[model samples]
Target: MADIKAVLPGDVMDTGAAARDGAVLRLGPGLVQADERTSAAAAGVLHSDGDLWWVAGNRRRYVAAEGEPVVGVVVARHGEGYRVDIGSAHDALLPLLAFEGATKRNKPSLAIGTVVYGRVVVANSFMDPEIECYNSHTGKSEGYGELAGGFMFKCTLGLARRLIGSTAPVLAALGSELPFEIAIGVNGRVWVHAEGPEKTVLAANAIRNSEYLDAKQCRQMVKELLAR
Candidate 1:
């Protein structure tokens, strides 16, 4: 007979029952599938059904359902929808409305290759977990090409998670008293709008490393460069 499942607050389990499938049975009630296996307790990584839903009393609670965070890479585009590559599952769906700063809805918005990271907002809502890209919230690029003065710079994907607002001065070498606008995008891109290319290159280089610059340092560098 298959054992029922359970969930507890702590990561460790002291008195979990075992199943014939070899996986540990959780502390509460859950009938295993006719032909399935589970661990005694969730000692290793858990492959959730969608997300863990706990039930019953606090001490003897049950993880009746299994689930995980919904993170995915955008792969293809459809009419007002996106096909994302969610590991181990089919590509998830992303709607145009899901994108922030989008004036229009029910049409194409995000481009392919734009990796969106987010947890499954609706795990059981669909057959698979639903993902809401963190990129969507950053007012992601609605425009496909360059802006007025110049195009944005590209960097490592990790930079997207550590977005520095436009107010923060990054690349110090660009110039001080620039008298121009510089916008840093959270999607690992930089937008510079100055009088000429010389100023643009200088600013781009300094700002590229802006993540390490302090306000005072940025000011000093901008001042020194502008005076040049």
Candidate 2:
């Protein structure tokens, strides 16, 4: 598990993280590399995950980072690609051929307002970020594609991350009660689908309510929800 601690702007981070075998350290959001040192650029919880370090804040607006999965809404069609809003300052470009087995003549015909699950392939300050609906390593969709049905809701980025963790208790608790499918985006969007609209809404609400609950609390909450 990663060690997480609260930090404020300008706080100096452990320099030893960058000194290991002269390996360059990867900085995530709210972190910046200074002259031979790493420091916090925003107020948030600092997280250290191996060679990758980041500070997670409570801001609703998302700053795109490469390799992060996101759920975006198609806003417009631009040339050979579609522009998608991923709750960031700039819309990301999703090329028509970015999908698995896609071609120029046969591409995904997504209409405006369609929700898509993708990964940020190119993220930087100079240009609009680029996203893709296929995993580059396996050349497969791998759950990265259009989200056709169900419901989508926004949560804090922190909650979204927690929901996607391998040991998320809320998901397990809900799963024990009823069958459902979920797609979580690191950018704060969660899509849930169940057998019916009522069950779907119940699952969504349960997850949303589990944000601050402990594991036992989550299970109990789910139990109470199912009973009612």
Candidate 3:
């Protein structure tokens, strides 16, 4: 046997992440690129257009080694469930039970733009990776949710990283204290939850402009309590 464990890339049509503009790359026969940068936790291989490039998909930001934790983004809210867009085409679902004291009715109260830092309960689900915010021993919000506030003023990915969990406080152009919560997914999807819609918009602007942010940036995000 030719070492069946060593799989090769399929045809271009067989690959799903072969996108243009650096979105994807075709490695070669039976091997396509699957990530642009490291820290993606997992990697993928495919054969698309006879080229190979790393495309980020459903890859965990941190490796899931039984007790390791990873962060993810929320893509959808299904009444009592949520679909997280953690670099995967198919968003993983966090059910009502995922939340503390959650019920069929109160389950729908959670916002969709929440980021969750959870322990990977079931890593290799058939279609997508599954997770549980609360462990079997206890129940909690899984160290995820509206952790901070502010909007992304800049559109670039670099600026987004600087703003996520940045201690920079947001003061409006008009001198109003901008109170907001910003959830930045590893995939560069920034979600903002502000006390006032206008404040949120300003924070987002500051986030976008993080590249040019001054020294007196918002250093204090909201009071945060999470596991290290």
> Which whole-number lDDT from 0 to 100 does residue 128 have in model 1?
50
* lDDT of predicted model 3: 0.44
Task: Evaluate all candidate structures by whole-model CA lDDT and list the values in order.
Answer: 0.43, 0.88, 0.44
What is the per-residue lDDT of model 2 for residues 1-228, given as tens digits with 9 covering 90 to 100? 368899999999975745875866778778887687789989999877667777889878888888888999999997889999999999999999999999888888999999999999998879999999999889999999999889999988889877776547999999998999888888899989998998999999999998888889999998888888
- Where model 1 places Cα greater than 4 Å from the true spot, the runs are 1-76, 81-149, 155-176, 179-187
- Cα displacement (angstroms), candidate 3, residue 52, comes to 28
- The TM-score of candidate 1 is 0.35
Candidate 1, after superposition: displacement of residue 196 in Å?
A: 4.2
Top lDDT prediction, candidate number: 2
* Among all candidates shown, the one with the greatest TM-score: 2
In the range 1-228, model 3's lDDT, one tens digit per residue, is: 011122323322333333444344323112222443222222343212233322223333322223323456667776556777555445666676765566666653446666565544554425455655656456666445434444432243334333443433333321344445555543444566676766566556555554565545433221110010
TM-score for every candidate vs. truth? 0.35, 0.91, 0.42
What TM-score number comes out for model 3?
0.42
lDDT of 1 by residue, 53-103 (tens): 112232221121222223345788777667766443345666655644444
| Winner by lDDT between candidate 2 and candidate 1 | 2
Give the C-alpha miss distance for residue 120 in model 3, angstroms.
5.6
